[model samples]
Target: MTSEVMIQSKFTKRFSKALMSLTLLSSLFSSTVHAHFQEIIPSSDIVESAEQRSLTLDLTFTHPMELGPVMDMAQPKVLDVITPEGRASLLGNLSLSSQSGEAKRYQASYQIKKPGDHIFYIEPAPYWEPSEGVMIVHHTKVVVDALNGKANWDALVGAPVEIEPLTRPYGLWTGNLFQGIVKKHGKPVPFAEVEVEWRNDGSVTVPFESYITQVFKADANGVFSYVMPKAGWWGFAALVEADEKMKNPEGNLVPVEEGGLIWVRTRDMK
Candidate 1:
């Protein structure tokens, strides 16, 4: 080959490699942002019989829309249950079980003895998100109705950040509108950003990548609403910065992204 042709070929190769690297980074960042959801899914959302008393919870940090790239979840900082009776610690019940290869997941099985609501909440270990240049702590929760429970789903679970459900939060049909108020420090966080997504069961195919996670903001009253588009589990996460800063693995103090997450399930009334 001619010297000029060889030079052009080398430059083309270098440019292609650089472009590929940039594309990968962009894709990774996009996936990382939407995957911040902290999931505490249960085996059942409604307990109706003595034979099905034990409720098993699946704990993980993942992108519900994509359903892959499951992030590693360390031991949770907070895991408890809130019932009409009162709040009690369920952290002792979480066993470090492996759901998939090398992905650390926590699972807890609780037997429902009462005929009310059981709210399972978790404050996961702060995850360091290098792409966003910050740490993320998603205080997540899910409610299970026991024998047609009451509307006690609006209780303040005392998370650093939380979502107080305005909807019934349980026993909902698809296409129902679910609403909640974002709260931090027991007060309203108006105009907060809430990211919404559904747990994909591999049957969904989004027309565009951006459609994987939907982002919306709460109103001035700290209230946000979303309609269930399909029959499955839906998650809402409201993000706010913590007043305090924590040191990352590199020993530099960084701001913490506090995400208040709530998971609710809907079904088609077939």
Candidate 2:
């Protein structure tokens, strides 16, 4: 062939090869992306027996974005529990701890009252769709049995309620006493008392009379605050008095009314 003819033929072959390679790479990447999005983790197979009393489920998710990019939209995954018979049992709403680092882990606890085979499904994405584009959905399932006895049940069902510290932004560190008030249902009743307790060496003591510096009334807002001389794990509870109509003829509050517990901790004071 002539020199120009040979050169044109070689250019055509090179272009064809490049096009074929691009097609193959596109097909392979599309298949891989589909598989990754459709993947589901393993499910639990523990059967429910009489011995099993409670069930606990822990879930974690990782996003491809950085912390600063999705900080506002970052939230905990939602967990939905459906009984074996196809009834919604427990729905937990959780959020990621502000203290969590880059991995972004959120946690929540659920208490199973009845014994049965339960199926849990979690969605690790936002509930509402954005106007811009649709977000990827990650879902998984698990089964649980509640035959593990009361202690095990409580371990899964009951957790220590987290209490946040109450402190001013900047304050002097002085050995001083503080007073707190408690109210319920927007009214202040006389019998509404608050008790402060603490624990040391696994022994709990009700030191309200000694350590409690003062007492105040819960205003119309039903709010209170107290300052502790020392820092430790402290518990507080309030006595919610019954309504006036429920009182007896002798002006004594009824006994059937429920009480309220107000628990908080002071991590630091400035």
lDDT of every predicted structure (CA atoms): 0.89, 0.37
At residue 199, candidate 2 shows an lDDT of: 21
Instruction: Give residue 35's lDDT in candidate 2 (0 to 100).
Output: 14
What's the C-alpha lDDT at position 133 in model 2?
21
lDDT, candidate 2, 14-86, per-residue tens: 9999999999888665432221111112222343453433444434432111101122324434456655344
What are the runs in model 1 whose C-alpha is more than 4 Å off?
Answer: 1-5, 99-101, 149-151
Task: Please count the clashing residue pairs in each candidate, in the order shown.
Answer: 0, 9
Estimated TM-score for each candidate: 0.93, 0.29
For residues 155-215, write the lDDT of model 1, one tens digit per residue: 8789989999999888899999999999999888989999999998988998897798899
Clashing pairs in 2: 51-147, 51-148, 52-146, 52-147, 52-148, 53-146, 53-147, 53-148, 171-270
